[model samples]
Target: MKIPAANRSFFLFLFPLFFVFHGFVRNARFIRVTDCLVLTGAYFLAALILYLLFYALLRNSINAALVASFVMAFYLFFGFIHDPLRKHSIFLHRYSILLPVFLGLTVLLTLYLRKKAPFTRLSLYLNLLFLLSILYDGATLTWQSLQSRSPRFSTVAVFSEGQPACDTCAKPDIYLLVFDEYTGSRTLRDVYHYDNHGLDSFLEAQGFHIQGKSRSNYWFTSFSMASMLNMSYLNGISHPQALTSDDYTNVWEPLRKSEVVNSLIAKGYDIVNLSPFDLPGHPSTVSQPFIATNTKLITYHTLADYLERDFGYVLQRFIPRASKLGNVYKTNETVISRTIQASSLHPARPRFIYMHVALPHSPFLFDSSLHRRSPEATNVDFRLKDYLDYLPYTNLQAKQLITAIKGNSGGKAVILFMSDHGVRAWHDVSDFSYFFNNQNAVYFPDRGYSCLYDSISNVNQFRVVFNKLFRSNLPLLRDSTIFLQDSE
Candidate 1:
């Protein structure tokens, strides 16, 4: 097509600019300046290919080229329409009809617009609209970037006692295994009506002292973990209302850069972090082969959850293969696999393994027998049955981890098994009780120091451990629990 050089340049830049804008918005958390440059370059290449094809198709008709570019720009910028198409499953089952109708409408609109306007007039209007949209998107991105750099609300600092000493001849390897949203046997039996005796018996027989009436210090993962790891209640140092806010910077800071981890490292222990969470100080033992081992992907798993809620069903109809990626039921089998590796016998430094297993938590992937549940069986609002259904899989994996670590450690390791919180189904008032009822168990080496009580809260866990093992005088903080509703 014999398009003006100005018009051709405008069309070429617009689509790639739109791509760059949207890509940056979607990936702002992980995107670096370098990444932005690469994304712009990639989209430019794509835009060039499309421009060549459209030029060839127009066959020297300047009007056709102008209209085609406008139509293409419309479709590219309005791709959010694809989201609505995916969100509704009923339309997708009959996508045979719906898809064709949509395509026909688009084609008809393009044809009408082409014949209605001269090339120069249409190009001028499109260029103006494109410039406005690009400016708006670019401005918004810049504002957000600046806002994210603003100083976050600071909270209390994490306090620690003197350096923990290894009183024993050899410092035992430490394992802190956390299963997300897992409740104790009491809650399992009383509320869920599921007897978790088998796993309890297995641990008991293996010499673990189970804290039967154990509770968590805080109501949620971030708060509970921060308290437990730092060995004190968050309210002690941080503002009393800090937990009421979702700003977990105080919690995350101590977790990623924890004195507990540092103390162990100073004492010749290698920190092995196997959680999917991006705790940058410690290297991950698991291989994240799916997502490139980058800072953005791991830290932003919540985005996947957001997509599934908004577009999962619709996506399933079009790209059935991509359903797994959208499936909230999917487990991090790689975590289990790598944990097994971490627990294996190797001639290395004494290790402290921190593993966060996010299963038996949501989408209720597995049944009582560790088999993946059918999609039909899965529910958005998982019930007690759904929670019970996942027990077998997690139980099996938990047993395997315990056995592997014990076998590898040669009777010289301390294993602490706990949950960040209990069953979080907020439907029933009584469900709140289980929220505080956490699963807690510890296996100290050679039937070592036993100050374990039946009613210990997570905050006092490491305090007791350091007191007994390291001969430190860390006092037990009084146990407490708070029922969290929201960030309000």
Candidate 2:
């Protein structure tokens, strides 16, 4: 099983490339093409450098390639090995122990490779394995691209057939402001023992009808948002099993190019996306804090992932300056500023502004006076005290945003102030019913709030809006709240 010298060297690069490509294929739906290319190039360059270093040390091509492969495999699969061991026993998973073990293994492997004859058979096996894996992933990626073009579950089909066109109707600038994880007034009173009367009063005084009994259609943000924007439940398209799955490609398609957005575009409304998620012809204004990025996905099962998950707080304590990089408050501030700026602009066509602000969500960044909390204070503990302190700041910002929008639009624009879902990390609360309770409010130019009911859910929010503003007879869906297990 003597393999050519050229073939042995080629497989060294192929293994690292295959690792990156495999990750890209698995998470292609979330990753942008540019991101994938950049990551792949970075991995390839690292592999080349490592191979050269090893070659210089060993003075043997086969030995160098083998050692390089061992190091790359160890680097890539560190988290994969660590996580399972961590679940069983914390002692087995510590970096202090694992690092030395990996180092010892690498040294032993390198020494053995230096002493032995050329391991052409091992090189040939790895080459075939990686080549076959690359081919398989390539085919999967190609098929997914083709499927996206002509999607089997078309979002257009979700809309009601024979819907009336509203070309001649008065199109007011519609503002859909979604405040993430803002619990309903009832949930505030029951779970947190806090009265949200101040914000409720402010909204009501501003001619906004607050849906007191409103709940989110789904527990998760993606599911709730996708259902609302599409004006339909994901009964047939997505099952309970799929809800827990990491692959959200099916959900993302309808979420981005929603039926509601398509309908609005058809009726001559300019889609202004200031949200944290991408939409049709418009990318996200800010990176989504809730979902992992392509880099995070590709680096999953590595030391980077372990540090981020387990020792993030420890890192934040020492490296306080770096904590601002993924601060939720920074993201919220950006969304608010962008929305205010966009509202000030006078577009020729009526605008459908979709602004999703992630506020009052962990890592709890701001306090009542809009001051940034200490890095040590920020946590995912779902503490009521943290949320209580953050709520006032959220209210203040909401008030400011409302005033700006109203002043800019001259009280003529249609504004829908709502939350994607309620506070999900209520660990202390025994009753999980409060998880579904969400904040919902609507403001129409003509004071037409009679159609909006208190118990209306997220799925029916846009339906009511379209019916009211565009004069379309889009039927309101049944208000139902479905709780998915492990939604958090």
Query: In model 1, how large is the Cα lDDT of residue 311?
Result: 52
Give one digit per residue, the lDDT tens place, for model 2 in 1-488. 33234345677888877887888887676667787778778777877777777777676777788888888887889877886788888785788898898889888887787778777787788888889989999999889877736432344345533678766779889999998889998889877889899999999899999898899988778778878888887644444634444534446666776888878887778898987666777776576546555455677667666666555666677775444424455677788998899889998899899988777666777777779777667756667788878898889989999999999999999998889889875566787778889989899989978888989998888888888877788767678887665422
Off by over 4 Å in 1: 1-155, 159-169, 218-223, 232-254, 283-331, 428-431
Candidate 2 — which pairs collide? 79-301
Worst 10 residues of 2 by lDDT: 148-157
lDDT for every model? 0.65, 0.78
Model 1 lDDT per residue over 149-247, tens place: 522322234334356565574667889999888898988887767889999999998989899889997776766776677676555333444343224
Error of 2 at 407 (Å): 1.4
For model 2, the superposed segments whose C-alpha errors exceed 4 Å read: 1-7, 27-30, 143-157, 236-247, 293-297, 312-327, 486-488
Best by lDDT: 2
Give the candidate number with the greatest TM-score: 2
